[model samples]
Target: MQDTLILKGHILHTPSPTQLVAISHGYIVAVDGVVVYCGKTLPSSYEGLPVVDYGDQLIIPGFVDTHAHAPQYCNRGLGMDKELLPWLETYTFPEETKFNDPEYARLVYSAFVRDLWRHGTTRSILFGTIHKDSTVVLMKLLEEAGLSALVGKVNMDRNSPDFLIETTEQSLADTKAWLEASKSFGPLVKPIITPRFVPSCTSELMRGLGELAKEYDVPVQSHLSENYGEIEWVSALHPESDSYTDVYYEHQLMGQTPTVMAHCIHLSDEEMDRMEETQTMVSHCPYSNVNLSSGIAPIRKLLEHHIPVGLGSDISGGHAVSMAKVLMEAIGLSKMKWVEVDNQYAPLTLREAFYLATKGGGTFFGKVGSFEEGYELDALIIDDTSMFDANERSLEERLERWIYIGDDRHIMKRYVAGRLVEEPK
Candidate 1:
């Protein structure tokens, strides 16, 4: 039977990167987890169909985290003093190495899953440690928690510490096995191809993984031009390539399938052109960019080039999981970028950052992050009455205040695919 759910609240969503659509005391009707109507008044067809009235609460699309490392859940807020490569060698690798133990993976991932829920992230694309068992544990936990994600078992075959690195053959075999294992998961939790960036993966491994990505028809995620040192290192490793982005493109990792590259703080004109041509998405991780001393990405330039852009928490490196805070940081960083570059790029507006946190990132998952007809009904019901919220404030103003100052305490409820998502066990 097709289930129908009707909700009424102060609705807000971004239909475009620059537009915010708000409806006071709005009604949203979803049938079988897809939105059919959203407007200021209940349509007659939906009348008397048992409305879930939220009164004065704010109902908005759930956040989509385009880039995060599941195994780094325990590493947030640690080792922020160093730059990207050193920080990874010192803190990230050691922490990720521990995930080889299934027990540890479960303990950490359970909390990570709960936190993603707490932060109102209904969907995410995450990277796991090389251990296939541990990666699968994350998918299972997310499935049980009723959240959605594209979880990857990370593959790194070179230039990594011996303890965490995988042999080329083992990496490919494990990844294929893991991909096959992922078939057991529900639709909400599926597998993604992760190569852990070019420096950590060799030509052989990248080629093999790219072939597998095509065979399995799964989306790909990796890092790109995140730090100057990292880009320099890539140039040294692949002297024949034209640019850092060229390495991934040459390996068939970028243009061959649906891919989302994180950081992208230093792409050249050629790289940007290729990105636009291939329709690859950039996961703009503002917090991590500053935290790791990675320069700010030319997000406005990328947008002008018509490249897809989205927000990412990049936890551990970023030190936060809340997309609300991430979007605020994104706006703040864009302002800084505008000042740094003599106003060549306009700073991002509140609506634009909100779009990145919603439909901007949500585009990766198809028909997500909005109240438009045919969108998946992933939403957050926020009760800001306790936050000194005023009656006269507009919905946009209230949402801005919440983004700047509110925490999970203001989130009263979360919905994924039109179903109420209870706290994870």
Candidate 2:
């Protein structure tokens, strides 16, 4: 018989908005990895199983970071004062160029995964450096760490520094190789197509990558309308197209598969309509927008239009790994948008913001980000005593406090696919 492990705690399942649920599970025979059994008394069948009781700890679904650059881990906080293009030229490109060395890739990638584990992000969508070797290094590290991730080998063929750019043929060949190499990566790690952005990729390269997406049926991720200058640059580069979003649409890259566009801050109504019709997800990286002077994403507008919006760290651009900080930044930036941009765009509440950090983003991966019955058992055991007073509080309050003030120190345990992989000291 497979080993059975029962976790008992105040479970905050993000099912039907925010509700507390009791969950129990064992290997293979779990309730689709979501602990289905909930009650004050254990079911008769669970009586003899080994139970790990977390008295008073808040058990919630593991955090899902919808967008991050794994290669930019070393460059976090380095180019804070510059706007998009200058920052790319002065700091971002130079830092990413260093990943050509396999040893450097291993060192940084290992540390990146460790930070994600420490911060309680068990599942992530990551952007790897353009170097194939380094991208592979990232995949191996995520696998070893037992993280569930969708990672991509970045594709850039034009408008970048010569050292960082690949020829159109070389870009397609390398990306195809990376896809083929990822076939055996197992469920925990999967490959996605990453076109650097509309400006860096020519029409030929973008169309070719779209073909590859069709061949492999993998997801595609890239930037869109992140900065005012970037939008103008895309317009200049693809004058034949109607708008920045139209460039991808013309190349057949949108709607055919799972697509995530980071930072849709300045999208037009037509772009929003297309995104909604195609079901493309937007990764709202608020900190990066504010830090780089990029515009705040109209998240309220996006959600109102039924666009799927999630959160991203956009490291080096935004400077942190903890999705906890991203949650705070998301709400903070929205309030700024309301104050400075439009009063009609009300600020996001704590529940809505936390939902974006968890279930809203986890939708990219089926059935994740909740402890409801039949969902995957990706979870975190958070110890919030540091902020808790002896005074009684509800489970929702504990979760709220943890999101606002907690760090890795508060993550008592982490589980993925019913397997206990990380335990706090």
Candidate 3:
């Protein structure tokens, strides 16, 4: 029988909307993972089980990062002053090319996974380099580290450095092979279709990938409307398509599979409507947008349209793995957008931003991002005794402070599916 572990803390469960759940098991078998053998009181049967008490600490679902380029971990903070296209050409492409070396791939991939744990991000959707071996290395590290993630082998056939580009046929063949090889790894680390974006992927490649998504019943992740120049480039490349979103729709990559698009910064009504209708997800990378001057994503508009939106670090581009920082950045950027762009687009409230980082993104995985009954017990125990006072704040206030002011130092314990995975060094 699996050993039962009970964790007591101020649980921030993202059930329905959001709530705190008492958590137990490799699964959250009861309210917040607690199993009651008798009445409301502690049962005699559970007396032998270990109960870890986190006094007044905030316990939340491990953050779900919906979009990031894991392979770019080495290049973070290097080309911050440049815009998207130039940055990609000069720094990003060249850095990604180095992943072709399997040894180098292992070194960087290990660091990336460690960093994810250090930042308390238990689950994520990540992009890997183009080389098959390098991508496989990334998956191996994630599996070893016990992180839940969806990683993709980037597919780019054109408009890229020669070292990074692939023949369209070769790209498809390699992608299919990667997906097939990934099947044995089980649910923790899965494959996602990553086209790089519309400009780099031909219609044939996109359509073929869409077919694979349907056949395998897996999720697809890629960039969309991230920069003005990129959007124009996509438009010029696909003249027959109505807009950037239409290009993906034309290839049947939209609704048939779970799809996540990064940065919907300049979407039109038609594009927004299509995303909403298809149940697509958007990853809002505020720091990346600000860093590259890519323009702020219309998050308020997207939310109003009932689209699923989540936070992304977009590492290298965004320059941080801390979703706590991303949460603060998201709020700050939204306020800037509302003030400078339009008053109608109000800033995201602290609660709304927290919801996006935890439960909103956690929804991608069933019953994640909350402490509700029967939910997976993926959570983090934070220690904030440094700021505790005789006259204290509420649970929400503590959460807000953690998001705005806290870092990995506050994460005392990290748990996934009720299994203790990482404890602070």
Number of the top candidate by lDDT?
Answer: 1
Alpha carbon lDDT at 267, candidate 2 = 97
- The pairs that clash in candidate 2 are none
RMSD score of candidate 2 (Å): 2.6
Any runs in candidate 2 off by more than 4 Å, and if so which? 1-4, 16-34, 38-41, 388-390, 423-425
Number of clashing residue pairs, candidate 2: 0
237-297 in candidate 2: lDDT tens per residue? Answer: 9899999888998897899888999999999999999999989999999889988999889
**Candidate 1 residue runs with Cα over 4 Å from true position:** 389-391
Q: Against the unseen true structure, what C-alpha lDDT does each candidate score?
A: 0.94, 0.85, 0.83
Residue-level lDDT tens digits of model 1 in 1-425: 99999999999999998889999999999999999999998889877789999999999999999999988988899888999999999999999999999999999999999999999999999999999999999999999999999999999999999899999999999999999999999889999999999999999999999999999999999999999889999999999999989899999898888899999888999999999999999999999999999999889999999999999999878989999999999999999999986499999999999999999999999999999999999999999888874467999999999999999999999999999999998
Best by TM-score: 1
Clashes of 3: 7
Better of 1 and 2 by TM-score: 1
By lDDT rank, best first, the candidates go 1, 2, 3
Error of 3 at 12 (Å): 2.2
